[model samples]
Target: MRIAVVGLGAVGARAARQLASTEGVDEVLLRDIDDGRRSEVAASLGAIATPEPQSVTAPPEADAVVLALPAGDHAAAALPLVERGVPVVSTSDSVGDVEALLDLGPLAEAVGTTLVLGAAFSPGLSCLLARHAADLLDDVTEVHVARAGTGGPACAHQHHRALGGSAIDWRNGGWQRRAAGSGRELCWFPDPVGAADCYRAGLPDALLLVNALGPVERVTARLAATRRDRLTARLPMLRRPHPEGVLGAVRAEVRGRVDGRYETVVYGAFDRPGVAAGAVAAVAAVAAVRGDLGVPAGAHGLGASTRARELLGQLAVRGVKSAAFTG
Candidate 1:
């Protein structure tokens, strides 16, 4: 199988590398505006990777394409591909960009192209965890997600902006907008990255969970931040963000009925955000190629369809395991 990865940044480069080594993947087409970066990534992947260095508007033909561009570029890169009936996997974490891509469901369906949205760490794996937890229950009512760590520089900047921006949450059968950095809640993730004070953020997970899970009541997403992080959120970043953090984690708390009784389920996974997101996007692209996911020809969140288990299983093989909270 041939897979195309555009925007060879931190996450995109990792996705391309994984795709190049994946079984049944004969070649990975690498595209980036930067010629040097593209060539470097292609070389790192050896003969299986081909650096296109072409504009995103004219991506090479491949069975599936992974779009790992910046926050605002997902829609533009996905549009032409979807119109051509090409399966797409996006790792965008931006709320607006994700919603814009979700709006392309009709167009993708018309062209018989399956577009997997938010195939990254938080929205991607977080959504998967939500699905897994909800499946253990008879029905689901509430889903609360918390995430810590950043992937690339862009991701860190987005996190900064998210804290300062207004957050959209689903509650009481309607969309509600609230202050982003308000409503503090203590959330505990897996080991090494334990408890943190999480606050609502402009994340795409809430919207995705509501759409993907066929939700009933409330859905909210939050990010872990420090006092300084929250204070500087409204201002421009003073310095470049770290290329990747030491570790990143996502937690999903699902509440609903189990055996007609009230039950709460929590599941989480931890890794470097960039690495995990890359793996998620790569696995999703491979699944799209292998038809293992059985996703429909339309835009969808990673866990929106019935392939959550399959996708999660594939991710586990790559060392991105999900842990359940026993306490």
Candidate 2:
């Protein structure tokens, strides 16, 4: 199958490279508005590169398009391809506008194509963890989620400046926002990465879990930086917004109370922001090409459904792994 990767930024570049190396992909097309970046990746991967999504999708030979663009641009990027009968797998986390995303589902179906959104690391793996936890329990009473990461230089720079330091939580059927520093500090032990500090942050998957598992009385998400300097720099930016470097860890913890017992599962990795994003994009792209993805079209978060496990398991075989931690 032929695959096209949209958005040649950090994550997009990584994803494009990974997809190019995957099995069963006859060709990989890298597209981005940035000419230099596109050319560089194209040369490195020995794949086709273009500046327009239309160019990649126009022929219909490209069976799937993986979107690694900014969260807000997902709908804009996806709608056009879905309308043209191109299946898509995306890493965008724009669940706040469900109605807008759902509006595109039919268009994809009309074209006999599939659209899978929210296929990123956190929502994708995090949601899978929650589902696994739910399956092990007789009843789920409360759920809490926390995540933190140092993104690429741009993302890291933004965090250091305290820009976008807001975290979202879902509980009792509503979404709540909190400052990055508002949650309590908890030390989580993730295998391979070791123990790290995490706090509550706003996460889209928490909301999806609440919808699937029932009303959660308390759900919190958090942020943490591997480098002290980065964390210190981000402290001030909590009061402001800025985008900068990206380098750090992506950590998430989910706690569920079942049958009067509390169980916690943690998922984390120390990786380049672009690398993780690229891995997610690759998985989504492969799933789409193989026609094995279980997600429906529309703008859905990774945790919106239980179908993500199949995708996550595929990713794990490629080097991504999650584990449970105690005290």
Enumerate clash totals for all models, in the order shown.
0, 30
lDDT (Cα, tens digit) per residue for candidate 1, span 1-327: 889998888899889978987989999988888889888998898999988745545656999999999899899888888888889999998988988998899999898878998899999999888988887888889999999999988789889999999898999899999998999999999998999999988998877788677756999999999988888889998788998766989999999998789999999999999999999999989888777765688888876768788789889989899999999
The candidate scoring highest on TM-score is 1
Which lDDT tens digits does candidate 2 get at residues 180-207?
5555566553544444566544345554
Candidate 1 global CA lDDT score: 0.88
Cα miss at 251, model 2 (Å)? 4.4
lDDT of each: 0.88, 0.59
User: What lDDT score is found at residue 323 in candidate 2?
Assistant: 56
User: Judged by lDDT, which candidate is best?
Assistant: 1
Off by over 4 Å in 2: 47-61, 93-113, 157-166, 189-203, 212-217, 225-248, 255-262, 304-309
